[model samples]
Target: MKLRLILSFFLFTTCFTAFGQEKKNAVIVEKGLIKVSVMYPYAEGKTFNMEYYETKHMPMVAGFLGANLVKYTIEKGIASGIPNQPLPFMAIGTFYVKSLSDYQAAIAPNRDGIRADFSNYTNITPVILVSEVIK
Candidate 1:
């Protein structure tokens, strides 16, 4: 019984150690392959249109550009806040492209289509940015 228990514990420890090592090796966040950023803007009188853009326009835009909408952050702006005050409604999107020029060209022509889709909003505008993951 003691030998059996020891063997079981050894197997469990081996499996756990292997899984932990795999997780460390498999994580690609710090490999400088992924891109990330925030899109900042304001949303005061354009709640409905903003929601429409969040749900409809962005998905269509992503589909058109072959990109992915990673996340969306909506916050109220502060008058006396820091120099880089966050926008009220920002749709953060990230695209994993091997090259920056390719990413730019991918969404170059879709600008007109995206503009037409969100033409109803006068105040709503997207300020897109990207950053590479650093090791």
Candidate 2:
């Protein structure tokens, strides 16, 4: 058991080194919560698109960008703060990024693929916000 723990610790350290231990360009005002609120129109009915986004597209984009997915939630009833309550099926994903540059680099190469994934939807907007974890 002790040997296994030591090995795990070594592997963890090695990964940090490989990924660059220095935390450069970290925003002074770190983003606390990252939320992607996708608003879908009533005309098309977002069931099919939602499934595709969850099962296929989300993993690819998040994995490609090195962001650990926090969670995905769907809003069924009337959501607060909107006059008409526009968004029907909303999906939220949270990720901890070392820096904005790191996040940008991860998504830069996969832009084309990401765009294609949302092509079927009438309207799709991907929003990213970073924040510091509060102690």
Candidate 3:
């Protein structure tokens, strides 16, 4: 049992080092309870409306989500880590929230409106994930 625990700890540390985790202060750690990432993948002959996504969609999301949204950041992808490589995603929107329940409750009432507005952004289906913060 002791050996297994030590092995698990070693693996976790190795993975953390490989991923290059950012060092954080206590305040930042407490602020991040959960993370939601929405990724718009790149595809040949596809279009994405940066203006609509940033200006219109995000505003609507803020209204619907309100206090549930602790903080959010949107990033426009330029290139991948590989030299002279195309980016896998056109854009990524990350949301930090306190809990899964809060996110779900916020989505429940505004799910239809959010879904309907998707057509205004891009044709490609977005990839989304909700992750609990390890710290």
Candidate 2, residues 75-131: lDDT per residue as tens digits? Answer: 333453567756543444444445546666777888897788777632545444455
Best-to-worst ranking by TM-score: 3, 1, 2
List TM-scores for all candidates, in order.
Answer: 0.49, 0.47, 0.73
Kindly list the per-residue Cα lDDT of model 1 for residues 47-123, writing each as its tens digit.
33556655676566556545333333333334424556644544444444445565567667886876776665334
Candidate with top TM-score is 3
For candidate 2, report its TM-score: 0.47
Looking at model 2, residue 29 earns an lDDT score of: 30
Deviating ranges (above 4 Å) for candidate 3: 1-32
List model 3 lDDT by residue over 1-135, tens digit each: 999999999999998876665444223635457888989899888788989999998778867677777777789888998998888999988888887897889889888998899899888788999888786
List the candidates ranked by lDDT, beginning with the highest: 3, 1, 2
- Spell out the clash pairs found in candidate 2: 30-131, 30-132, 31-130, 31-131, 31-132, 32-131
lDDT of model 3 at position 121: 89
Candidate 2 — which residues are off by over 4 angstroms?
Answer: 1-48, 67-78, 82-85, 88-92, 127-135
